[model samples]
Each structure stands twice: as structure tokens, then as C-alpha cells.
Target: MQDKTNNQESSLTRRDFIKTAAIGAGAAAIVSMSLTEGQSQTQPAEAPKTQPSATPLKLEDVLKKAREKLYPRCRVCPECDGRACSGEVPGMGGIGSGKSFHNNYDSLAKIQLKMKTFHDVKKPDTSITLWGHKLAVPILSAATGGVTYNMGLKGKMTDEEYIDALLGGCIKAGTIGMAADGIGDPLDIYEIRLKAVAKYNGKAIATIKPKTQEEIIKRIRMIEKAGGLAFAVDIDSAGRAARALPGQTVEPKTMKQLKELAQCTKLPFIIKGIMTVEEAEMAVECGAAGIVVSNHGGRVLDHTPGSADVLAPIADKVKGKIVIFVDGGIRYGADVLKMLALGADAVLVGRPLLRGAVGGGQDGVALLINKMKNELVDSMVLTGTADVKKVKRDILIV
Candidate 1:
């Protein structure tokens, strides 16, 4: 058998040789003096000839490094004045037309600028006290259904494991986990999350689908008994079936019905998918504790304004009367800051969590959240804000 270590050493270039030598020397010294067995073993046997100095890395640094490694230069085509044009290169494949706001780097740059300003502004207290539980951050894992179906990783994530991971990650991140109804039987999902919450000491927000007032009431009672912190109904999806999955129906709940449901649950009642001020006021009239200004991630309605677009108006209308949350196309910590600046109490993430789940299971999910949180803190520090609550609207241009 060939010696793998010898082969590795032989394959090292001159630069690698110098780097390894320096690293090895430093590692050997540290190992020799260190008492910890694990720490000592991590050091290389040979002294390194050229190694970089040991610099402590903050979470923000790690995330920045990761971002640089993961997302390269902006490859998407620049959108010209109102024309939908597709630009394709030989090796890069086809990139979508820049006509969509999401596809435009300039729009993203503006959002980033606003985010930085918000971060520089006084940091708002990110701590939130809702449903009798105090959370470290206002962000929540929005109730997103069909994740397993969409990702085609059903067998990879067991029901218990998935629930446990979601609950655990949420707790670790100091946020609440919101689970959508109709992913499975309501009672079964409730029970699974109940166990996860108890075990992880986490909070859960169960979103019941639109149903008859009586059924809604029953589900609310069940959620309360199951020890959930909040109850919600995704009103935007009501009376509609997902185009991705035609079998899944989202029956819309009326204001009267929502009011009755709110009255039934002792837990905080949140109404998801309020796109307009009219709907937001109705949610308040229906006695909602919070309103999530969402557009179902553009999965429900095409060509609708992004959630960020409507957040300010809705926040202005509701003022201080209700807790405001928003979700849609939030992929970074700066995005979270932008939403908060726009009057969102916090922002919810959906697809990112799913991506994390697919890529790394529970630990991957944790990594994804930790990365986001670190980015958020970095944004805060760079903008001169000390905490989450101090983030304000004046920090934004639009």
C-alpha cells in the first residue's frame, strides 16, 4: 500500500510547502505546551516554514468569508429601462431577464445601502416578549408548507427529526418556530411540535388553514393544549390551491370568522398574508395580536408587490396597534434590518431554512441561522447600532 501522507507531501507545491512548514512549527509549539489532549492532537507533526498569524475570528468575519466563497461576482444581466432581456453566455448558461426587481443588482444595492444606514442608526432592542415568552430576537421561522415535497428530500428528513431540528434551531437562534397546517394532519403536526417544544424549551406558532369558524376554534384549542406560544391563519392563501401542488387548498378565512377564532385561542393570534392596509385593519378589527405582511413568498400571487414594498404602508396604518412581521425574499441579515426599518417587528425566513435542511440537516439549519445572525450583528456594528430595537425607518431611503 502507498503511503498517503508521503503522497500528500510530494504533491504540495512550493507555496504549500512553506505554508505547511510555518503552520506546523506554530502548531507543534502550541501542542507541546497545551494540556488539552484534543487541542494538542490538532497540531501538525512537522514544523511549518510559512504560516499566517493566528487571528481570532468573530462570527461576522466567518460569514463574510463564507459569503465571498459562496456567492461570486454578480453574474445576472443588468436590466435596462423597462425592457425584459435575457443574457446568455457560453459557460455561464442563461440568466433571467433583469426586468424583475429581484433580478436587478441596483435595487439590491439600494436595499443594502438602506440596511447599512439602519444598522448605523441606533440599534433597536431586538428582544421580543410575545405570548408570555421572551425571545432573544423578533425573527421567526415562518410557517412554510410543502418543503419536503418541493425539495424531494422527504425520505432524508424523518418527521420527528425535521420537527426536532426546526424547534431546536429556532430555540438556539432565540426565535420562534412557526409550522404551517395541512402539511400533515393538524393534530399529528401539533403533537409532534408539542413534544419538540417541551424538549427544546422553544416556542411554536401553529398556523391553521382556513376552515369553518367551528373547526378553526377547535384547532386553536388544540394548539393551546399542545403548549404552542402562538396561533395563526394564513389568510392570503385562503380559498386557493397551490399551483405547485393542486391538491393543497388554502381556504380563505373571513374577518368575522377570524375574529371568532381569535376569541377562541388564549395564545397570541397572528394573521399571515395581509398585503394591503384594508386587510391589515380588518386583522386588527378581528382582534389579531400580530399581522404578518406577506405575499406567500410570491408563490401564491405572481406580479404582486414584494412584501418589502407594502411593509411601510401597512406599518404606518397599523401604527402601534399591532405587531408587524414581514417575509419574502429575505436572504441576508441586511434584509432583516431593512424589514425592521420598514416597520416590521421582525422578519420570517422560509426557503433559506429549507436549503439549509437539504444541505446539512439539523446542523446545516443551525449554521444557516447562525450565519444570518452574525451578518445581522455585523450590519449593526458597521452602521453603529448596538442592538436590534434601535433600528429605525429614517435609516432607509425608500
Candidate 2:
């Protein structure tokens, strides 16, 4: 019986050993398959590389490129010939004597002063309600003539395109646009600008340099019919001319003439080219809803003090009666801030738009306006003003 039991145990041990060996072989086969699959599925890691096409160009870079490509350096140095040293020469080549040309530096200085003086201590309210329309900022595109003549791609765009660019770009950027009349027959330019303003749903102040009060009324009526929200008489340009251009021949409308024209239109009346407090007061008394305290952008009288310089006094005198606006050498948001601080309800941009138009048409104008708006916003943020109306005199150091 012992021999039989030993034989059975030996058989069981042999069977168990065979079963273990078979399972080990199967497991080895499975491990080999998994290793092969893993090797097949694995990918080698690579170092990251930058693609040239994926990099973004900054706005300054884009503008620099565009400016280089489109605009040539201005050859005419009007500033150098007209700048007068204070206390050095009487009637010398300087602003304020009518013998010199417009100087942006002078304009900027005054603008800075007004901005610092008025805006320094006072809370600036940049938001303006004019003619029942709310504007984000008071900086409007003042009515400018000869933009097409001065700057265009060889007249690539029509008058309508010019107006469209100004209205759609500048007006939409938070400023109203004024269209200058008397560049040609009043009706044609007026109609073109009116249509452009309607297209953009923007506000426009149409200006007429009429030969007579009757003509002023007729032009004002036409402007209103064409959807102009305000009317301005370019009183400064009535009998003035720049260097060689044919002088404009509008009769000097009396205060009564201005009032009669204002009465003819239901829209707000804006008198452009006011440089004195007395003139500002007269404008208000004449029922002017607004007064543009400008020196015809220093075009009419070359040697006049920069528009910025006179803004504070005029603004102080006419604060409650009318919306005080200014134009001249406004190149940046800082310039706008300076004007606002000085007591201007708003400011106007002139040559910069022409520069943009000359450089890139509508896109160029839009770029210029966008840059200005961004600059304004940056200034506001840096000064800790959240709202446009909050920009005050204290924000400026000088």
C-alpha cells in the first residue's frame, strides 16, 4: 500500500510541474506581444519650433510699415519759416502777427496749459450732449477744406468717400464730424457729406461761408434738409486766404446776420473761429449752441496764439452758455487730454485725418482714429479715470 501511494504522489507532482510550465510559456508569449505593440504605438518627442507666419505684428509695427510705404516726408517746412522768437522781433516770423505760419508747438503749449489749469483741479467731463446726441468724447473732426486737394491718392477717392471715412471712422470713434462747405458749390458738397453722415448714422456740423446772409439762410436750410444736426459759419475764413490759394470772398456777416441765419435753422448753430472771450460771448448771445474757439486752425491768421493757449480764457468766459470746442495741433490722446483739462468741452482733429486719408484711404483713416482713441483710453487709465467724463485737470502734471 505504501508503494502504491508513493507512485500516485509522484504522478501528481509530475502533472503539476507540466501544468506550471505550460502557463509560464503562455504568459511569456503575451508579454512579448504587449512589448511589440507598445514599441509600434510609441512616438519620438521633438523639440518645438516657431513658425514665422504664426507671429503677430504689433499695431505700432504695422503703422510704421504703412507710414513708410505710403507717406513721404513733408517737404514744406512751414513751421520753421513762421516761428517767431518772443521779445526778439515785432511782426517777425512768429505766430500771432498774421505774418507767420501755424506752429504746432505753440498750439501744444497752450493746450497743455489749459489742460493742466482747468483739468488739473476740476473733474473733466469728456462726455458731451450736443444737439440731443450723446457723444463719447468731445473731440470732433472739425470741418476742414482742401483735404482732397491737400491729401488724396491722386484723387483716387471721391468727396463722398472722404466724408464717409471721416464720419464712419472719426465719428464712430466717439467724436462728431463737421463738414466744411464753400470748397465748391454749397449744394453738391453738402449733399455728399449729408449722405455719408446718414450712411454712418453719425452727427455732422455743416459749415457754410456764404457771400450774403440770404445765402447763409439758404445753405443752412439745405444742410438741415440733408440731415445735418448742426450748422457752423466759418466766420474766420470769410475773407481770408492761405499763402497762395485764392482768398475766399464771403462778406463779413454782422452779429445780426449771424443771428438771422441761426434763426433760419432749427438745428444747433456753431460759430467756428472764436479766439476771444468777447467773441465767445457774442456767439452765445447770437444763439450759438456751440462755439469753436479756433483761429481757423491757424490757417486764416498764421501768427495767432495756438488755439490751445486761448481755450482756457474762452472756456472760463463761456462755460455755461455754449459748448466750447477747440482745434489745432491735436496729434495724440495727450493733446485731447490737454484740451479737455483746459476747459474745452471737446477738441477737433484736422491734418491727421488728411494724413491718414492720404496714406490709406478709409482703412488709413480708421487706423488713425483707432490709434487716437486707444491713446485717449490709455491716458485715462494711467490717470486712474475710468469714465471719459472723469478726465480732469489733476490728471496732468503740467
Candidate 3:
């Protein structure tokens, strides 16, 4: 009786149901008019069927739609200048004044590739062997994360899901993937990510934040256990004084401390966040297997020169001494080629790969990588460069 009473209180009448259906589905009622008025009522002509386009939507087009629907913090803009997202340090923006972020883009833009012709070159080989792993291209996805803080939860992807797409996608595309360590993230997160990475035959690399020596060493041990090919530490993260987790500390390392850490690890130890020539020299001196010319993606400090502007000097000084990799403002394959000409053995792509992984998963990442590779090849052919390994300095319009 009580259930009957509740049903009766909210019951819908037949008229109400019809009205609701009409309102909900936009049902058009064809009421029969008075038959006497127009006995010979003519039927309406049939509408023509629209044909679907023969060409399918490209992966980039699909990614554009996914960007709108899934990604929250990042809009995946056509151009990723710092203007749309400024002073967004804890997230994706730069620190303090946002000048550092702007500098990365501006400095890279200042470099112009001198076009050339009249050389017998077909397709340039764009492969490089790093840390005993041969990559299809001289490009790899930079270590990027913080889906909750950096990209946002609305991306409809978990940290694990994102990393799976990122690392897995890169590996599938014939390259390496770099996994990131978040300050706020728990330790187990790294374990889960590395477990996923193991399927790629340890081609995926990992980067640790500048945690304390004990913490850094502990994490390095974990990476070693995970069958990782190499590991890196972003020392520039020390500038992020405002965002460190409680009980976590990031400090500058002395030469002795760096050598100690270097000696402890058997893996190819890479030191990221080298901005100036001095730091680049110091990194090699400390027994680094490789050094990344980066400004922490301009997230650590404000008003620093972009990695591109300083890359040539660093490369000239330590080109053969230590393997040189660079990141920042690398939007396309042309940019990748530019970095190679300026003096980078390889380049790390950050946000674009994130968007690719979020939008189309493995396929999306592979497509983006292919796009960059295609563009790099096109740039190489036009410049009459036969081999990617021997990209001449003269090709650059310094």
C-alpha cells in the first residue's frame, strides 16, 4: 500500500507521457487536417541522402576532438606558447613571471635553418643508438606526468593509463619513452609504471626528481630493479621551492655528491636541467653518461634563456664528451631537425606527446611520432642532408 501510494504521487498520465515524448525527442506531429479542405493532398518530396566523404578523418583531427572532450587543464592549442597558460607553475605554466616559459619558445624561434639544394640525397636515415638501444628516430617523449595536477582529471585517463599510452606508444613507434616521477605521487606509483614499462624490453627510461640523496638513491634502486635502460635526474627542479611535498627536500649537488651517485648506479646516468655551458661541463665532469639541455621546461625558474639559445655553445664545448639531448619548444619535426643541427643527439618532446597519448592512445602517439619523423625527413631531403647522424652545422643559419 505504501509503494502504491508513492507510485500514484508521481504517476504520469497518458497525455503527460505523450507530451513528454514529444518534448524530449522533438517529435513532429502530422495532424490530419480537415479532409474536405484539400482532398488531393500531395506528398512531400524525399530528401536527398548525403554521402560520407571518401577520405577518413586524420589522427590529428580525431585528436582535436578528443582534446576538446577529454583534456581539461591543457587545451592542446594549435600553438603552445606561454600566453594561454602563464604563472601556472604547479601545473603546466612557468614559475613567477612566466618569462622562462616564453623564453624557451622565443629562443628556439630565433634559430633559422638555411635552406639548401643541389645535393644528391634521397631519404635521410633518422635513427640513433642511445644507451645501446636503437631508436627509429632521434626523438623521444620527454618524461611528463601529473595528470591530476598538470593535465587534470578530466582527461578521462588515469596516471597509469596515461603512462601506458606514453611509454607503450613510444616503444611501439620504434623509440624510447621516459616516465616521470611526481613529487606528490606515492612510491607505489613508480612500481606500477615500471611494471608496464617492462613489456617494452626496458626501452622506457625514468627520470627522478632532485629528492634528497637517500630518496634519490632509493628511487634509482627501484629503477634498476625495474629493468630500466637508463635514468635521469632533473636538478633544476630545486628552483620549485613553493611546490615540494612535506618532508621532501630538493637541493643542489656538489661534484663529489654527483660523482658518488654516478658511481653507485650501473645504468646510463643522465643529468637533465643543464642551462649554461658551465653546468654542461660540470655534468660531463661528474661522469654523466648524457646531459639534457633543458630549463625544466621553464617550470623551475623565471627569466632563464631557452634551451635552444644556449644549446650551440654547450654542444660546441661538450659535443663528444657527453651525449647531448635537448628539450623545450620542440613542436614539430622541423624543430627536431633544428636542434640536431644546433647540436643535439636527440630531443625530448613533452606536451604534444601527452596530448597524443590522451587523444588516441597508442595509435595517436605513433601517428604523432610518424608525423615528426616525416617532417624531419622532408626537412632533411630539402636541405640535401643524406645522413641524420652527420647533420652539418653549416646547414644552420647562425
After superposition, the stretches of candidate 3 with alpha carbons farther than 4 Å from their true spots are: 1-57, 69-72, 241-243
lDDT of 1 by residue, 1-398 (tens): 37998898889874455445444433332211111112222121221222333432232322232222222211111211112212221111112332222422233345644334433344334576675677766667776554344333345555566666666556655566776675334466656656765565436787877655666777777677667778878876562544324434446666677777778756889988888999999988989999888766554443556677777889989967888888866777777877777788777887566444433444445555656766676666666656665566766666
Q: lDDT for every model?
A: 0.58, 0.59, 0.76
Model 2 spans > 4 angstroms off: 1-104, 110-126, 152-154, 183-186, 241-248, 384-387, 394-398
Over 287-336, each residue of candidate 2 has an lDDT whose tens digit, in order, gives 88888877665556556677776788887788867887788778787778
Candidate closer to the true structure by TM-score (higher is better), 1 or 3 = 3
How many steric clashes between backbone atoms does each model show? 21, 13, 0
TM-score ranking of the models:
3, 2, 1
- Candidate 3 lDDT over 338-398, as tens digits, reads 8998899999998778877876675467667767887888899888887777888888776
Each candidate structure's TM-score, on Cα atoms with residue i matched to residue i, is 0.69, 0.69, 0.83
- Error of model 2, residue 255, in angstroms: 1.2
Give the true-structure RMSD of model 3. Answer: 16.0
- TM-score of model number 1: 0.69
Cα error, residue 37 of model 1, in Å, equals: 20
Alpha-carbon RMSD, each predicted model: 12.1, 26.6, 16.0
* Model 1 error, position 285 (Å): 1.2
